[model samples]
Target: MDQAITMNKTSFGTATTGKLGMWLFIVMDGLTFGAILIGGLGLRIGAESWPAAGSVLNVPLTAFNTFLLICSSFTMVMALNSIVRGDQKGLVKYLILTIAGGVLFLCVQVWEYSHFIIGSEHLESILKGAGFTGSQFLPTTGIYGSTFYATTMFHGLHVLSGVIYLSIILSMAFKEKFGPDNYDRVEIAGLFWHFIDLVWILVFTVIYLI
Candidate 1:
């Protein structure tokens, strides 16, 4: 009976092993991001003074980028629905739009990073010109700069990874590899993409908007 039960066991829960593994990975990754953000928040709160995000960063531009990511998440949903409904053309269209959004988001991030971190003027000079200076809130603002760059870059890396993953899935989708009969791969990719979007919402709130 034990051997039979073992042989019959296919899932740890309602999810198959692959799905379960993905969920576990998402959970662990979430915890890692949470730890970093919380530590940054603690440092910010404990500090004597921290620069306002608006003064140090381009809030409006980032807000637009955030909008793009939200739109991408919606397109991803449409793509998944298209596959489930066996609308191959619709799936392809939405998947391409989603990838386009991801690419645009990354491009904007690169521009932002370059504007701040890699320009003709040092970040310190730029910050000083923006009215943030001294030890309180310049480029040399110690923990603030460290935490901000660390968190944003880590999230950017995830965005890059998600784009590559979605692009591969999109290629498979163009070949009609997903349909109602077998769309688990599309669903899995959607899950990861949605997670990336959700994490960005948190990062935008904490790091950019406050």
Candidate 2:
């Protein structure tokens, strides 16, 4: 009986060290994002003219995107919980749902950028090249578009990367590679997922509605 207890799994699938490594990567990423946010705030502060965040960006759409991310976070937790409880089916279900949510949010972002941001930037470049100088590219021309594109797009790329990470994790999950005995892997993924969600909430408040 003593040997049985000793034989219990010591290396949770990928080891605790690997889990901690993933967490460290997340913390470092948070720091990098914090730097970008601070830089933007500083730029705004020093400017004689600052653009408003609510003018050009679509507030309603951003609000929807914010909700989508929040829901995905919940789904991530559900996936982790299911795995720990040995319910592989539930785990796969929630993981797929979370991935779908991320994809939907990304699609919305692409459409928004296409309609308001990417198009504008291309237009600006063309005008500048033609010597038809204009301030349309300037943040103050419309506060919403400028900061919206800057902050959200910055964070959006992070979300895109995160989704890719989650997709890989989910693939392993679907193969029945992780379960109640090996829950650490899902926990690590959960950490990154929640961090992405938190960052988006902050971005929405500071860059879209504020």
> What are the TM-scores, per candidate, against the unseen true structure?
0.85, 0.79
RMSD of each: 6.1, 5.8
**Model 1 lDDT tens row, 1-210:** 354344335432456566778788899999999999999999989988777767777789999999999999999999999887779999999999999999999999888877765544455665776555542332454777788888988998998999999999999998998776566788888888999999999999999878
Model 2: how far residue 117 lies from native, Å: 3.8
The window of 10 residues in a row where model 1 has the poorest summed lDDT is 3-12
- Candidate 1 whole-model C-alpha lDDT, 0 to 1: 0.83
Across residues 151-175, which tens digit of lDDT does each residue of candidate 2 receive? 7767788788878988988899889
Model 2 — which ten-residue stretch has the worst lDDT?
A: 135-144
Off by over 4 Å in 2: 1-15, 118-150
65: Cα error in model 1, Å: 0.3
* Candidate 2 TM-score versus the reference: 0.79
Clash pairs for candidate 2:
56-144, 57-144
